[model samples]
Target: MGAPRILVVDDNKDMAQGVAMVLREAPAEVESAYTADEACARLGERAFDLVVTDVRMPGQDGMQLLDVIVERWPRSKVVMLTAYGTVQSAVEAMKRGACDYVTKPFNNEELLLVVKRALRERQLEEDLQRLQAEFEGRYVFEGLVGRDAQMLGVFDAVRKVAPSHATVLVCGEHGTGKELVARAIHRLSGRKGPFVAFSAAALPDTLIDAELFGARKGAFTGADHDRKGHFVEANDGTLFIDEVGSMPPLVQVKLLRVLQEREVLPVGSSTPTKTDARVVAATNTDLLRATREGRFRDDLYYRLSVVRVALPPLRDRIEDVPLLAEHFLSRRCSERGIAKKRLSHRATRVLLLHEWPGNVRELMNVIDRAVLFCQDDVVEPKHISFDEEATAADLSEPQSYEATKREVLERFQRLFVERLLHECDGNITEAARRAGLTRAAVHRMLKRLGIAAPHPEARRG
Candidate 1:
């Protein structure tokens, strides 16, 4: 937290002193080392925030020192200084763990700029690590991983309402972990019976009644033998009903009756059966809106939503992407019996910038695929791919049709522009020309869409 400590290492005493003096402009604690061995000695004594080392040093070269620092210190950033002819070597050093590199004839401003950028990036990584450590076990509930305010609120609500006998309604977009939340609630509910799950969307209207309420031996066609329904099977336990909004009108009325009477009237049965099932329903549709539109019953909606749990979409909680990605990566690697792999800085940026239309499910799949395809110990940007065809799910809460249309159009525009820029090798002028648009218009669009313009070096690459 004090002024950052920096070490300048070069075989030439004059050159080392000169680099150290230039870094004084940063108001940093700067020291000079005439050899890589001397630099190692200094590093062993105390940690330095950044180390600027020449690529070709006498006896022990800068590359050897880089390997040592990477293996031993790990956190301290190293920047390579190379002559014009050895720029390729500097780049190789970067791949081996150097934060950045500067050419020998670089201006003081250029060197200082690179150093400051590296320092800022190091700080950001440290902050993210601290946050991950702090929230790893605390914010995680069951299999869910998040530290976002909205997710934290969901966790808190689940804990408080799990012990009660209320009928809970979980509302979220598809793949936002609604089922995971239901399981967590069930685990915490301390029920004596096993948890039973049923999806109304996965069944036909004719079979939904038989599935929810038990049937007699000759109840209807295909009712060859007596069978217990979800309510009966989940007796004295939690019954997780997914896609509850898809239930037919008659089934909804029957469900409402079961909730009120604490029993189920089986098909072709003379007497009602008593049951004590705790209902936990989930839907990706806006049931309240459905009620107003007369597509769903208002009384049923109210009864099901006794304790509502709303989950925010992935895009709304982008900061948790890194944590979730790491979780998925670790699990995938362990499952495959492979050594752990890590994401490169560029790969991490790729993950962070994505919109994650499929939420956690999509992220997990991406990580699994990356782990399976990555050849090295690190996952690079080239190994990361997004599903271009997966459009965002419909909003769980109701919104004006025009607003929804605008949102969808913006998402499409952003994806189109990104692909264009990528195909043109990140050259704004080339992308604009190819797209039949002005370069200025493209720049404006990038700014409006909160997209970072590609760096000149990246464009060349």
Candidate 2:
């Protein structure tokens, strides 16, 4: 909330003070430590937002200090300082949990830039943690995690509407967690009956009526025994009807009658049976458009959407990707009975850059696969593999010529730059040289492509 506290640790008193002085130019409280032990002592007294430490100290080196800080004060971010020859050690320090690194002969501007970036990152991390705590305490809705304004509004809506008997309509793209929202509403509704879910799209038109409104024995070809429909099965509770837009016209009429009369007319029976199910319907299609087009009944649409909850796609809330990734990683690791693993900073950047057309479900699957394949305690960029086919399929959808051209060019540029970097072993300067461009040009290109460059030391041509 106030000026960030920073600790500069170096065995050389002059180097430590000089680093501290440079950092003091920013709006930060800076202190100097001549040894790792003294740095630990300062940390014990109070937490510092960021620690800038030399890689090769006298007694306990920066790497050891990094381990201590990571284990004890997990919130504090560390930046390693190394000479040009010792850049590898700095890279290793990053793998061990340091936020960033700087070479010893770095310029004042460079040091200040790195320190400022580290401080900003620390602040963002703190903000995310605070939000997570707040959501967990107030909402306490399991399996839902987000800091986006739209998602927060959805949480608020669910909390306010859960105690009511009104039907809820949840609309979102496929894999956007529409069902999760439905389940959350059901959980908080304080109903005594079990939650029952049925998907209209999962069944054929012939069986939809039987599934939703019970079928008597000998009523249909496969009706060997009398069956209770979803309405009766979910009596006094919530019935989640997924892909509600896929319901047939006749079924829609029947569903409306059941909603209006609180009863279902089973097939092959003249008498209607009373039911008391609370309906929570979900759809990925535009039901309003369907109503206008005469494909979906307008009356049914109005009846189902007494309380509407719209979920934003993952791309709309890219800022929450890191938090969601971490959540999936932790859960996946626990399920596999393995030690907890974390995503590397570069890997996190890669995820943030992704256009998750598949939304939250896709992200969960990606994290699950990454955790299963990652060999070490950290998941790096190499371990993350996006669904290229899915992305390609998305690009193939109908669009304007200019939109298609722009998307193709962007994809080509990203692929070309990535291959160039790979050929040069992640050296941006060499990659730039091969592409007949300046290093700064290549840097800008990488930024535009949402590609995270290699370590700073790796970029020095």
Taken over the whole model, the C-alpha lDDT of each candidate is: 0.87, 0.86
* Model 1, span 320-412: residue lDDT tens: 777788889988999899999997755666666577888989999889889979989999767887887432443244454345445645776
Pairs that collide in candidate 2 are none
Residue 24 lDDT (model 2): 90
Best by lDDT: 1
Model 2 root-mean-square deviation:
16.6
C-alpha RMSD values across all candidates: 15.8, 16.6
Model 1 residue runs over 4 Å out of place are 1-134, 389-461
lDDT of 1: 0.87
Alpha-carbon error at 264 in model 1, in Å?
A: 0.6
